[model samples]
Target: MKKQAYNPYLPSWEYIPDGEPYVFGDRIYVYGSHDRFRGNAYCLNDYVCWSAPVDDLGDWRYEGVIYPKVSDPLNKDGSMCLYAPDVTVGPDGRYYLYYVLDKVSIISVAVCEEPAGRYEFYGYVHYADGTRLGERKGDEPQFDPGVLTEGDTTYLYTGFCGVGDRSRSGPMVTVLGPDMLTIVEEPIFIAPSEPFSEGSSFIEHEFFEAPSIRKRGDTYYFIYSSIVMHELCYATSKSPTKGFVYGGVVSSNCDMHIHSYKPARKPMYYGSNNHGSIIEIKGQWYIFYHRHTDGTNFSRQGCAELIKFREDGSIIQPEMTSCGLNGGPLAGKGEYPAYLACNLFCKDEEIYTPLEVCGWTAGSLK
Candidate 1:
């Protein structure tokens, strides 16, 4: 019998958040920032990868440490942490991983011949004048890079704007040339930040961080984490870098805005910052996201939910569930682990996980 996929698809001890999933060849590989279990900071470990056959979602194999923290030239001592990353196949058919260090504002590139193989430091994304993308004059700091390549052009999405911070604009997109490192087009803001979202459609859910891009048919889907911090929202546009209208919440870690089963305002679980994107597996679409675990925000676990679209191209947000990626309910009733509980709460009706107890502050992204 085939195995059933459950939430936290990887081993319970692993904490990989900000997942970017891609189907290359016959398997689907997941690349994201690795987090140390119960660590003091986020993404304290090296970059690791996990993959499974396209036909079996439950049979995941560890790809080991594909990229180490010391691999980058900037951090030879490995003091800096690796933030969220995204991968794309370059024009030369080599897999390119784009990431940003926790202490830097510039994006870094790593390349490998195979999808899940070891990656070497390629170069930093720079302009024709050799200035780094984010270090140049009047350039916004880049964070959480998400890339999509078509033909010889690649669109790189990146930005991080805190609430009421006027110094930083919203998420921006820069076009990369065939070399995958040189900037072909200047950076442009694609969405409004919290301080500048007064008259925009994204006033309620302005982009905070985690900008991921996915294209289906002629529509471009921009998935990001909003200012709320617990939900993953999406926006769509016909063009790659313009005219994006805020859609709706994709998945909330605490089930915040879902009214199908309970009150829309009541949170079902302890949630904090969320980051993930959507992907299609075997003709079915799903959203891959992470949830806080071990009573702390540093240790997070990944989860997925089946997503459906209306004829108008709008997606209804899915509630947090235990039967994730199973395609439906479990077949037979049996004892399950308590960590699989989707609806977690105490008698006091606490909504969010206490960050102070975990030595985490409110506005700290890392």
Candidate 2:
């Protein structure tokens, strides 16, 4: 088959957002929340998986619906939905899927024999008495799970920024035993208040949801969408649960363009929240994130860019491009759709065009 590639990475019809990429065996599987095709509510569809071989960036295969919404306990009345999730291979050798039941305010668990296979309900992250953590704890929304396992010890990070519920705080980190279903310790407050700079206050790095944790060498990098709303930031610590210092902004869904959330001298393209993590595939590093379309936040798509770290561990943020996931620029001879663009916005007058974007589709290039 002829290989295909685009900026959104997947086909236009596939509206998978909040992508959490995990490399299992030879394929890099993207486990994320499903959005309706132009529908209203957020994350209105079932969980689907997409994967590609370690050597092939253009060949992506959909892994089918791994878990349906009806399978969730909170969806019994057909109301609640699952949000962004992360998968980690457990000591038992099974893949554990972690996500939150949005309306019910609880973090749930599911397990799959294979990385991209059907996942059955396992249990919920709860206290000793079996009461769910999110429901029993403070009024924070249980959303955007980031999980990791070191040897027999497993860690699950779940939290909400002020975005959903303004009362909510930064992320919470908890230890999961070898069983991968139980919370073994009291969940610890892990981020935001941690100083990111020499004199920066605790409020500087306040959370915005979408937590992603990765281990590079001896440093534990906790990546997430911050209060700025359009970009992803990171913090580094020797331990998974505490003592983290600010890293830097990784990438923006809007390409760091016209967004005014942080007083950009220039602005990012699409004004939407971004979520994704960094992973080393085939010895090369890449930052995975999402983009919005149809001028609405609901219909989002997954996007990625190759990134590299300096000798001192500083990350150089890459510019958003149509060549993402392709490893290089596409053939550049075929006609593509308008929404694939990461930069296409009009100025208040006819003045700003820093990205050199052409027209708004129909006759121009994306």
For each candidate in the order shown, give its overall lDDT on alpha carbons: 0.90, 0.77
Write the residue-wise lDDT of candidate 2 on 262-361 in tens digits.
3454554645677889988999888888877665678888888889898978788787777677767667686777766666645431222222333443
Give the clashing residue pairs of candidate 1, or none: none
Candidate 2: segments with Cα more than 4 A from true spot: 1-4, 137-141, 163-166, 193-204, 257-264, 347-366
| Cα lDDT of model 1 by residue, 1-366, tens digit | 667787888888989999999999889899998988999999999999999887888788999999999999999999999999999999999999999999999999999999999999999999999999999989989999999999999999999999999989899999999999999999999999999999899987999999999987799999999999998999999999899999999999989989998899998778889999999888988899999888888998888888999898989898888777887776567666767778765554556778543332221100
Q: Estimate each model's TM-score.
A: 0.96, 0.89
TM-score, predicted candidate 1 vs. hidden true structure: 0.96
Give, for candidate 1, the lowest lDDT window spanning 10 residues. Answer: 357-366
Pick out the ten consecutive residues of candidate 2 with the lowest summed lDDT: 348-357
Q: In model 1, where do residues sit more than 4 Å from their true spots?
A: 356-366
What's the true lDDT of residue 218 in model 1?
Answer: 91
CA-RMSD of model 1 = 4.0
